[model samples]
Target: MGRRPMPVGTYGKIRVESSGPKRYRARCRYRDFNGKVYDVERMGTSRTNAENNLKAAIRDWVTPVAGATVTASTRFRDVAARWLAELVRDAEREFRSWGTIDTYRNRLEGLVLPAVGDLRMNELSTPILDALCKKVRDNSSASSAKTVRAVLSGVCAYAVRHGALDANPAREITRLESKRAKNRPQKSRALTAVEVLDLLKRLDQDERAAKDDLPDLVRFFLGTGERTGEALGAHWPDFNAEARELAMSGNVIRVRGRGRIVNRGKT
Candidate 1:
C-alpha cells in the first residue's frame, strides 16, 4: 500500500534580546525537547525582519508534519546506530561496501549523535534536519550534506516501513539542489594517419628531454593500457597464467569517487 503524504504548515516563533538596544540582534531559534535553543539564523536587523526570519524558520521546522511533536529528547542516537547495524546485516555483498557502511557510520557517529543523539526517533523534525544540513554545507562539501540526507532518509524510511512512525521526517526536508554546470564542447582526440605520423615525429624529438623512466613507463602503459594511477598501483600477482589476463581493484584504485566499483577479491 502507498503511504499518504504528511501535513505541512507555517509555524510561528518566539524571540528575545538583551538590553533593549535599538540595534537588536534578532535570531530565529528552535526549542528542543530538553528546552535548549537551536538557532537558524536567517538573521535580520529589524525586529520585524527578525520575527519574519524566526517564523520562517519555524515554518520550515514544523510544517512538514501533520501533528508530530518535535524535540531534542525525541531523537535517539542508539536507534541510529541500531539501524546502521541492521543495514550492515541485511546488505548483500554487491549492495554493501566498506565505503557505504562507513557512510552510515559517519552519519550516526559524526552528525546525528552530536545533536539530539539521546532523544527518540519520533522527535526528529524538518527544521532540525535543515539546520544540520546548513551547518554541514558551511564547512563541508555539498556531497557530504547529501550523504547525510541519504542516511537520514534510510533511517526515517525504516521507521515508516516498520510502523514505528507515520512518515519519514526526511521526506519533508528539501535538498539543497546543486547548480548544474554548463556543458562545454570537448576537444576530440581522434587523429588521422598523417596527424599520427606528425605526433610520432614530435615524440621522437620530445624523447631527448624525456625522463630516464619514460621508456619503461611507456612500455608498461602500452602493454597494460592502464591509466597513470592504475599503472602505478598494479602488482605482479594480478597476472594469471592460464587466462593470460590482468586484474585490477577499483576501490583500491580510485578516480573521482562519484560511484562505487564492482568488488573483486582482495589481494
Candidate 2:
C-alpha cells in the first residue's frame, strides 16, 4: 500500500525470463544538462538513449504539452502559466505602456513556469525551488535572474492568493544581488560659472538652429521649470509680455503618453 523508495540516484532493472534465480540490477547516471556528456555509474553497457532521457528528466527539461491550458489542472507549471495568462489579461486593459506588459509576458512564458510547470502544485518544495534557481543562475545575467525570481515569487504569490497553495515556496529563495546598479549620492551637482556660460552658448546656438517650436519649448522649459504639458496649457493672451509675467487664469497640465491627471493649475 506504500510507495517504494526511489533509489536516490538509481533505477532497478529486474532480470527478464531467468528461471534459475531472480536477479536485478540497480543503476544510476548523473549527466549535467549544462553542456556535459552522458555518464553512467556501475553500468558500462548502459544504452546511451536511456541515459540521455534520464538525465533530461532529472534536469527538469520536460517538453511542453500542446493545447493544454494551465487552469484545468493543478500542475505547478500549469498554474504558473495560467496565473501569467491572467496577468496578461488584466494588464492589457490596465497597463499604460506596451513595455510593461511585454516584459511581464515574456518573463512568464520564458522563465517562471518552465522549470516547474508539470509538477503538481502541492508537491512543490524547497528542492524544486532550489533547482529552478540553479537553472536561472547557470545561464542568465544577474539582473535577469533577479527579475525571473521576482516573476516566480509573484507566480507563487498568485497561487497563494487564489487558494491553490498555502504558502509561496519561492518566498524562501534569497533575492539576487543587483551588481550593476550604483546607489545615488545624496549631494546634487551645482553648475560652475564656466559651465553655466557653456550651457548658455549651447542654448543660444540651439535657438539659432532649432526649427519652429523647439526653441520656444526650450525657453519655456527654462522659464517655468515645468514639464511640456504645463507650458502647452499656458496661452500668450493670458500673459503680460511687457511685465514678463503670465496668469494661468484657467489652464491645466495633463500628461500625455499616459492616461492620468497628475498636475493641474488655474489662477
Candidate 3:
C-alpha cells in the first residue's frame, strides 16, 4: 500500500543533528495548505533549542493566499493593511461606496492602529479589545468609539479568515456608551418663517454670497429639503419642467484618490 500523505499544515517527525562544534539543526517535512510538501529547518545553539525553534516555525507557518503574507505572528497593523486592500477592491467593484472605505481607513489610521498596531494577531484578547473601546469612549466621543470598535472588528475578522486567529476578539467587546449626553444641551433648532426670510434678505445683500451663489443654493435646500450633496449633484436633465419636479438620483461624494464624483443617492 502507498504511504498516506500527511494532513495539510502538519509536519513529519523532526530530526536534530550537530552541524558544527556547538551548532545544531532540526529538519522536518511539512505539508502546506496547497497540498505540497517542503523541507523546513531551523538552526540553534543546542539540540533542545533547535527542536524548539523548529516547533515555533511550524506554529507560525502560513500559506500565502493570492500574495497575502499574514500569519499567526503577523502584527495587527499588517492585518489591517490587508483588510483595507480588500475594502478598496470592493469599492472598485462598486460593491461598496468609496466614502465608506475612506471612513474605515481614516478610523483605522487615526485611532485603532495607534492603539494596538504592534500587537500580534494571537495576542488580541477580548479583554484587550474591551479596554481599547472603553479608552476611546472616555478620551473621544461615543461616536468615535463606535467607529474604532467597528474598524477593530473588521481587522480581527480578516485575521480570522486568514487563519491567523480562531475568532474575532473585538466581537466580544461591550457596546460603547456616551457619558456626556446628560450634561450637553441641544445646539440645533428649526428656524422660524420670519427668520428664514430675514436670512434670505441678508444673503441677497452680501456680495460674497452673491458671487458664490449661496442664495440660490440655500433656496434649493429649503425648497427640496435635500442634503447639500444631493442638491449639488442635481442636473438640468433631472428636472421635469412640466411637472415642476426634480428627480433625486444621486449625491456628490469625494473619494480619496478619485476626487469628487456623483454616487447613487440613498434609498
TM-score of each: 0.45, 0.42, 0.75
The superposed Cα distance between candidate 2 and the true structure at residue 53, in angstroms, equals 20
Instruction: Give one digit per residue, the lDDT tens place, for model 3 in 1-267.
Output: 999999998999999999998799999999998899979999999999999989987886755445557777799999999899998888777777777888888889988888899998877889998998899889888888898888999998898787777678889899787885666776888889999999999999999999999999999998989999888888899899999999987788998888998876333
Tens-digit lDDT track of model 1 for 1-267: 897422323222455453355544455445544344455544456677666756655543422233533322245665576577676665434445545676667766787678757656666777888777767765676777788877778877765655445578787777666545479678778566787567556655675635445545555766676776565556668778799887765334321233444333232
**Tens digit of lDDT per residue, candidate 2, span 66-113?**
453322136776676666667656645543333444565576678866
**Candidate 1: residue 216 Cα off by (Å):** 9.0
List the global CA lDDT of all models.
Answer: 0.59, 0.56, 0.86
Best by lDDT: 3
Give me the displacement of residue 77 in model 2, in angstroms.
Answer: 4.8
Q: Candidate 1 or 3, higher lDDT?
A: 3
